[model samples]
Target: MIYREYGQTGKKLSVVGFGGMRFGPDEDYGAQVVQRANSLGINYFDTAPFYCNDRSEDIFGKAFKNMPGQYYVSTKSNVGKESTADQVRWRIENSLKRMGIDKINFFHMWCIMDLNQYDRVMAKGGPYEGALKAKEEGLIDHLVFSTHCKGSDIRKIIEDDVFEGVLLGYNVVNHAFRQEGVQAALENKLGIVTMNPLGGGLIPQHQDYFSLLKEREDETVSQAALRFNAAQEGITVVLAGMGTIEEVEENVKIVDHPLTVSKEKVQEIRSKITESMDMLCTACGYCNKCPQKINIPTYMEAYNLSILKDDQETKHRLNWLREQEKIKEDDAKTDACVACGICEELCTQKLPIIERLKEMSLKY
Candidate 1:
């Protein structure tokens, strides 16, 4: 139930914020999870309509009926170039209705990946105007943005000075790449909420890579991730998408007395990880915008596990990789890569993707 100052906003938020993307099908179970989170002093809950095929908001609707104003609700607007201000306001109003809340504490422009998208949103008659209008009308308290852009582009987004805060991907493997953005947010006094603190499950998948984070005998890989992110200098909160009550309790325990790891220790861990594995995919999803839609991150994770962990774990990940849906434009497979080299260019870590794909193709 520990809290931290959310930048300079005068708001104290739970160090472990609830991400509403993974709520299960059981209504009562979801409600109890929310209730338990509330009892543990988790006040910040974030969701978007696209998450869980839009059922996540409905779960919140049921969970927040009598507990109004006891928590801070955060949601996003998914709009495009043709979207008007009314449409943006409608998105906000719809989220409010679904969550049974009067107003949202933070409303974000969701999934903005680059300056092109940012310009489109801020352009005339775009969703940005609609969000501003909603804020003026008291529907939303603050304006924010969520991005999956490269680390270099992240500071550019912050420099626009439009958003009060930002949500971006930051985890153990990608900390060095993301540190620039974190520093910029700190400079701007923006509230920094990091998503994928576990590298979108990559940390759990490669437990041996993050051994230095395990300070206590009872600590799990995920707990180490939560502590690592929570201890970062400018981070406001670390959001972990928990589907079950067990996940919630585990996260609560870690954040209740979150451990702080030193920079030297972190660098030593990174060095060891570098020595242990030939491929390093932080699962940032930057290279996921492939024309062929090859699911590079997932396969790369499986590949790393295959080399680092036991064969059974590797087989499990490979099976998981096989089950993932591919883009309809082409038959997606490891061997399907045309070697256009677009992914390599976009890759932050400069992974030898084509070579890896060639290697992985034999397994299929």
Candidate 2:
């Protein structure tokens, strides 16, 4: 795989790193996946304490138990001083135990969103302080953070200049170039690695990213996305979710022969993706479990991308969601919603789903 320097650390990492979240099957699959990735020159692997309810860490730990120190491992903490101090250490130690590792090459504070949340962590003896304590004790080698927000929020964090790197879900499909966070990461020379390089693995739907390519059937969507996201400047690593052994190999092949998406293609993809993702739901499975037996977002997603347009990509995403228990079989459809607004109250996006679902269900 191709390598790039991670910020000012002078540490070179593969352009395509293995993401630990999608490793599947068997009890020890995590270790199996990591070892395979390591064998393929994937020096970087990212896992979090909350991934797979922490089982992901356990699996990752088992995978690299006897491996050399060449590969770099990174984990994240979700203890945000929003919890008790005990919860803070519990989260960190639990990751350590699960990974069976002494130190994380990079310890991200996880994904911080708004300025209010940012301010809370910056306060005296706050979560940031706790992370620093871990770093001082050699538990974490570098301090980093991740985000799904826009530029202003990201700028707020970099203003402190306390972090060594930043991780965000960037892709050719949703370049989010207009976002201040992307600009700041580039301007500040922070370790700006990208996640969801395949646009959160909407592998079958790459054609939709570019309006010009919407009707193109020859190109593989995955290849287009990987090239597009990896070609940009300032991206240290482009994280790929290589669940299967073959997928990992494909990514390695691409990194060896690096290429990029053009600016016109980038703009085309951005516009198409923006037009496609009506609810801004990348099917991340964040808005889950409508108590009234409603599938809410997924149903709308299905109506638009699957039932309405090409079902290939939507089906791929929904299949993964189904495996995660996020998709309840035969759950309430848009037509089933009675405007009770119960699902809306539970929705983090506060999406007017009960109404939109009806309209979408009818249209798509």
Candidate 3:
């Protein structure tokens, strides 16, 4: 597996880091998996106190017995405004006891997804201060946060210059990083980590976002998805929670290969993807001036993409606006355009906005 820098510490960590959330009642099996992966050269192992209700860290410790100093162990604490210095320190001590390590390579502040979460951590009496104290006392090597919010929220956290690393959801599914603001974060040395690498196992169990590439896909779904992130600049590691030995072997093999999908292949995949898309609206934005002033492109794209999957989560979020009566449940689709003739007049493509929204309405 390729290695990359771990924050400013300059430690060359394996880009395919192992996530310990799956270490469960089968502690011995879990350890075996880690040992096999380590023997093959995966050095970064991440676990957190809250993962699987604290059993994961303990299992990680048991499974990697006597492997101290041979691998990097990363875990996080759920400490916050309510946590005192003593509480935070106690948690770290407990985590060390569970992981069988005196010092952690990366000690992240867990599950921070909003500005308020950051505020709570950076408060005068917050745990973020306690984390800094732990580093001073040699308990932790770095501080980080696993965020699941938009670029707007992430930017707020990066401005603090407080995090040694940033862990966020990055995958081929939601390419939020394509946005200019998200792109800026990569340009800076924030030490990015990708969570939900498989879109929460969508590629393995369900269909990959690039499933349209089946005609030309020379690699496995997981490999294609992983390479997508690893090829991107600023992503040091892509973490995967391997639950079984077979998964460990497959993932390690993928990482051992080149971390890229060829550009020509990428263009072809994009072509198939667009062609497979049932939405022909093309987001021409002819209806830029709506009386309700709804974000036509934003809502419509979300609506079109939602139909691609039968997954409950996708439907739940997609149905949110429709369920709220913003758009009629039946007529509620990106295709549900009244086409008031305003955006149509401005359309350079002369896309039939009203007709397209009408077609979209039929799909939902």
**Best prediction by lDDT:** 1
Where does candidate 1 stray beyond 4 Å? 80-82, 274-279, 282-289, 293-298, 306-336, 341-352, 358-364
Better of 1 and 3 by lDDT: 1
TM-score pick, better of 1 and 2: 1
Return the TM-score for candidate 3, rounded to 2 decimals. Answer: 0.73
The whole-model C-alpha lDDT of candidate 2 against the native structure comes to: 0.67
* TM-scores vs. true structure, each candidate: 0.87, 0.78, 0.73
Error of 2 at 182 (Å): 1.4
Per-residue lDDT for 1-364 in model 2, tens only? 6778898877788878888777676646556667777887779898876566556777787887766447888887654533433455566777787778888888887767556666665667667787778778888788888865556768878867998788887764456542466678778878887887755555455344333532234445575566666777888888887667777776776654436666676666555554455433355554456656676667645644643356565656666766886765675655666677655543423345666676655653
lDDT of 3: 0.67
lDDT of 2 at 217: 47
Ranking according to TM-score, highest score first: 1, 2, 3
- The model with the greater lDDT, 1 or 2, is 1
